[model samples]
Target: MRTEANRRKINRLYILGAGASYALTQGQTESLVAPLDIQFCQRIKDLQQRTRPKWVAAAARRVEKEYLHHVDFQITGLEELIRQQISDYEFIAAIHPRRTRGKRTKEEYLNDLNHLAAYLLSRARARDQSLLEKWLEKYLKGTEKRATRNRIITFNYDTLIDNVLLNWHSPQHVYFDNIWSSSTKSPTRLADRYPLLLKLHGSINWRCSEEEYAKLFNSAVTTDESKTTTYNTKDCHYIDKMWINNRVCTPEEQETPLIIPPLPQKPITSIAIFRYLWTYAYEYLYEARNIVIAGYSLPPEPPRVSRRLQLLREWSHEQVKQVFT
Candidate 1:
C-alpha cells in the first residue's frame, strides 16, 4: 500500500518506442525478433518460410526492389516506406498498373499497404511473445503501487502492454480509448492511479465496427460493446488465417487495425479516436513531475507526434523537475 506522501511523488511518465521492445527481445535467438527497417525486409522473407500470404510476399519484394535498392536516402523502416508510397499516390493512380487493382481505385491500395504492414508487425509480436512477457513480468508487475501513479505512452502498435496489464491488473484499472467497459459503474478519476497506459500509435488488438468508428467523433466517451472488440494480438490471427485461406472476408473480419500509420502527417486530426488519445496523453503529461523516455528517439519526420511532444515540453516546462532518457 502507498502512503499519501509516496503517491504524491509518483508523478513519473514513461515513453516507449520500438527500440524498447527490441532491447527486451535481444540475445535469446540468432534472428532478431522485432527488427528495425534495416532488418525488416529479411525478417519478412524469413516469415515466408512459415505461413505468410502471397500478397505479403509480393509486398516484401516491392520493399526490396523499390525501397531498399532504389532509394538513396536513409529510410526509417518498411512501414515508413509503405506509408510514404501511400501518401505520394494519395490522390493519383499508380504509374504502373497492378493486377489486384484492375477494377479498384488507387485509394484501395492504401488498405492493402496497411494490411501488409499490420501483418508483419503482428507476426513479429507473436514471435517475440515469450521474451516480451518475461520483461513485462519483471518490470511492469511487482510494482503495482508505483504503477498506479505512473503513466506510460507507447508509440508501438503491439499489444505487449495490454497483455501484461490484463494479467496483472483488473480490466477497470487499465483504460483503453476503444475497449468497452465490462461494468456500468461510475469511472474512478485517472489521476488517482499512477500507471495509466496510453498507446499513442494505437494497438493491434483494437477492432471497431463502422458505426463505432463514426460514433468516436461525436461522443466524449464511446463504450458500446456491440460495436467494439479488444482482444490480444493472438486472437487477431483468426483474421490473418482467413486471408491465408483466400476466403470471402466478412465486414467484421475486415475491420481495420487501430494503428496510426507512420505518415509524415499522422492522421490524428482526421481520426477522432487518435485525437481523443492525444488529449488523454496531454492530461497525463501535464501532471507528470518526472519524464523518463525509454528506447524512443524523437524521430523528426512524423509531424503530428513530434508536434505533440513539443507541446508537452512547453506545457510541463515548469512542472517537470527531472527528465531521464
Candidate 2:
C-alpha cells in the first residue's frame, strides 16, 4: 500500500491526447469524424485523377494494382495492410503471391502506410483552441496548491495548450514550452527539477532551420527559416514547423506558414526527438502523484508506447495517487 505521505509528496502530471481537447466541444469532435483512412483513399484517387509525369503515374498504378487493390482498396483498410506488411509480410505473401510481389519488402509498405495515415489524421476537425484555453484556465486554477507541482505531456500537434500557458501574451502568464527556443544560455535547471510541460509528440508551433539542426540536434526557434530548430534529446525532430517567422508585418508575409494540407496517407514515424520526450514523460507519469488522462484511446497499434505505460503502472503497484493528493 502507498503511504499517504508518499502520495502527497509526489508530483502531478496530465497526459492529453488529440481527443481531449476535442471532447470539450462536441462540434469539434464532429468535425474530426472524417476518418483519416477514408480521406487517404480519396487522396490516392485524386492522385490518380491528376495528370502526373508518365513515370510517376506508372509507378503509382503499379503500387495500387499490386498492393492497394489486394488489401480491399478502401481507406479503412490501409492501416491493417500496413501493419501486416511489416509484421507478417511473409504470411501475407503465402495468401496472395501476386499482390505481395515475390520480392516485396514489408518496410516499404509500412512506409507508404505511415505517410497515408499522417495525411488522413491531419484532416481531423480543427480544434477550438479558445475552448481549450478555458478548460486549461479552470484546470490550472484548481492546481494552485503550493505543495503540488503540475505539468502536462501531450502528443497532439495543436497549440491550444500553448496559448493558455503563455496567457495570451499576458505578463502574468510566464509559462513557456521551450520547444522552439534558440537560446544559447544553459537550460534552466528548474525545468529539470520542477514539473514542466513536455511535448512528447511535438507541437504544431515549433520551427527550425537546417543550420540549427546541424549545430543542435534541434533548436527551438530561429529567425532564419533555413536555420534548424533546436530539439532536446527527448523528442523526435520530425514534427511540423509550428509557425513561420515573418519580419514583414504585411498580411501576405503573415500567411506564409499555413498549416500543411491534409491528405490521406500513412503514419510518419515520430521524430526520434519525440521518442525521447515520450520516454521522459512516461517516467514522469510513474513518479507523479496525480494523473489525468484525456482525449486518448490508447491505441494498440503503437504497442511499444502503450506497453511502456503499462509497465510503469505495474511497477507503481497501481498505487499512483491522483493530483488532488
Candidate 3:
C-alpha cells in the first residue's frame, strides 16, 4: 500500500482556459492577447491584407492555396462559428451531397479546418514575449529548483505557460503523459518527479506522426531513430523533444509545428495520449489540496443591435469554486 506522504507531494492544481492566455496581455503596450473564438473571423479577414504579421501571412498563404469556399471565411459571430466548424469533417463529408454548388469537397473542407487551426496558432505565436513571466515573478519570490508542488492544466493552445515552466532543465522535467507508455507511471524519482503541465486541448508546440508532419510541410521524411525516440503513431513529441531550438512553423522561417486542433468535432478519447493526460489530471484532482481555475466564462456574445442590460451568466456557477493554496 502507498503511504500518505507519497500521495500528497503534488499539493496544488491549476486549470487554465482561453481567458488565461487572454489575460497575459492585460496591461501591455500593443501586445497581442490570445484570440477568443470571436476574434477569428476578423483575424481571417485580416489574413487577406497584404500587410500582416509574418506568422499571419505565412498561414494565410497556405489558406489561399487550400481553403474551402466558406473560407470566404466570415462568421457574423465567432463562438457560433467555432461550434459549427468543430463538427467532425468526416461527418461533413458523409452528409455533403455530391457537386453541391456552395459546399466544398471533403479534402477541401479538411484543409480549411486546418487552415483555421494554423491561423489560431499563428496569432498566439506572434507575441514577442510571454507576460506570464511577470505574473509569476510577482508571486514567486526566488528561483525555484527542479521540484515543485504546483501542477498546471491549460486549455489554451498558447505556449505562454509552457515557455514559463519549460526551463528547469531545458525541456525541464515537466511530465503530463509519457509518450512511451499507455499507462501513467506513479510518482517516482525516475518518471513522475516533475510538475505536470497538462495541455488538455493539445498544445501549439506538439507534433504527432513524423510522416504526417513531413507530408504537411513538404519535408523529406526519414525514420532516423538515432535522433528521436522510435517513431510512434500513437503519441506526440514536443518540438524541442527531438530537436533543439526548432519551432513548429513561424513567420520568421520557423519549423512547422503540429497540433491536435482545439476541441475537435470528434471525441478526444480516440487519441491515446489524450486519454492518459486526462486520467492523470483526474488522479491529481483527487489528491489536490487546492485547485485554481484561472480563466473561463460564459461571456455575452457581441455586436448585438440592442444595447439593453442583459444578464451576465457563467457556465461554472453550476460548478464550484474554492481558489486558494
Candidate 4:
C-alpha cells in the first residue's frame, strides 16, 4: 500500500488525453491543438512547408511527397495509413545507419519525427488553461500545505500538466521513486502537499544524449549548452534538453525530439524509463479514490498498446467506480 494512503485519503486522480490540451488552446480551436494524433499528418505537412532552415523545409516536403503520399491529408482514419507508412522499410530505412540505401536518406525520417517533437515542445504554454488550471487555482487556496495527495496521469508528450505540477511541487516528488529504472515499483510513499503528474508517453523535454545529438545538430548549439543540466546514467551522459527554442529548429541546429511517435510497438518502449512509467500508471489506477478521463479515447490503431491495455475494457463492466469520460 502507498504509505500516504493509509494516513490521508488520496484525492481524485485525473487521466488526461489530447482533448485536455485541445481544451487549453487560445480559443480551444482544433487548429491550435498540439501537433500529434490525428492532427500529425496535417500539422507535419504544414510545418514542413513553412518551417525554417530552407533545407529542412525542402527535405520534409520531399519525404512527404514520396513516402507519405498514400495518406489523404486531414482524413479521419489516417492512423491506419500512418501505421502502414511507419512500418514501411523502403522509406524509413534511414533510421538504421547501415540500411541507408533507400528512397529517402537516413536523415529524413529522423528529421521529420524530431521536427514534430519540437513542435509539441513549443506548445508547452497549454496546461495552465484546463482542469489543471482550475485545480491548481483551488489548491493554492486550501489550508493543506502538506499531507494531501493528488495525481494526474497523462498520455500527452507535451509538458503542459508536467510544467504546472513542477511549479507547485518539487520535481522529484512528481514521479515514481527512481523512475529512470525500468524495474522500479511504487515507493511505499511519496512527498506531500502537491499532485504528481505521470507522463506515460514520455515528454518532449525529457533527457536526451549530447553525444548522439551532436551528430544531428551543428556545433553552434554548444554555446547555450552550459545553461542546460546534465547527468550520468549507468551508461552514458545525458542532458535534460531537447531541441532549442523554436517551432522547428534550423537544420544546422536540429536536435532530435525525444517524444515517442504512436507506432503499434514503439521502438523505444524497451527503454527502462517508459516501462517504469506504465507500471506506475497501472498502480495508480487501482489506488485512486476517483478517476476521471479527459480527452482520451484509447484508440485501437496501435494494436500493441490496445493489447497491453486490455484492462481498460474492464471499465465498461464496472470494475472501477465513478469514471467520467
Best by lDDT: 1
lDDT of 3 by residue, 1-325 (tens): 1233444344666777677777665444322556666666666656656454455555555544433335445542443444445443445556874534465443333334444555455346423354456654443213434445667766666666665555533332453423311112222234443345766656656544444333432333342332322223233322322222224444333233344443224234334444445545555565556677767653454523211111111112222244542
The best candidate by TM-score is 4
Off by over 4 Å in 4: 1-9, 26-31, 49-59, 66-69, 73-82, 90-111, 124-132, 139-145, 175-195, 210-255, 267-269, 300-308, 311-321
- TM-scores for the candidates: 0.64, 0.49, 0.61, 0.66
Candidate 1 has what TM-score? 0.64
lDDT of each: 0.52, 0.42, 0.46, 0.51
Listed per candidate, the RMSD to the true structure in angstroms reads 8.8, 10.1, 9.5, 8.6
Model 2, span 207-314: residue lDDT tens: 344332222222443322322222232323343332322121111121221122222221122334344354455556556667777766646545454543453345
Clashes of 2: 42
Ranking 2 against 4 by lDDT, winner: 4
User: How does candidate 3 score on lDDT?
Assistant: 0.46
Error of 3 at 251 (Å): 13
User: CA lDDT of 130 in candidate 2?
Assistant: 64
> Could you give the candidate ranking by lDDT, starting with the highest?
1, 4, 3, 2
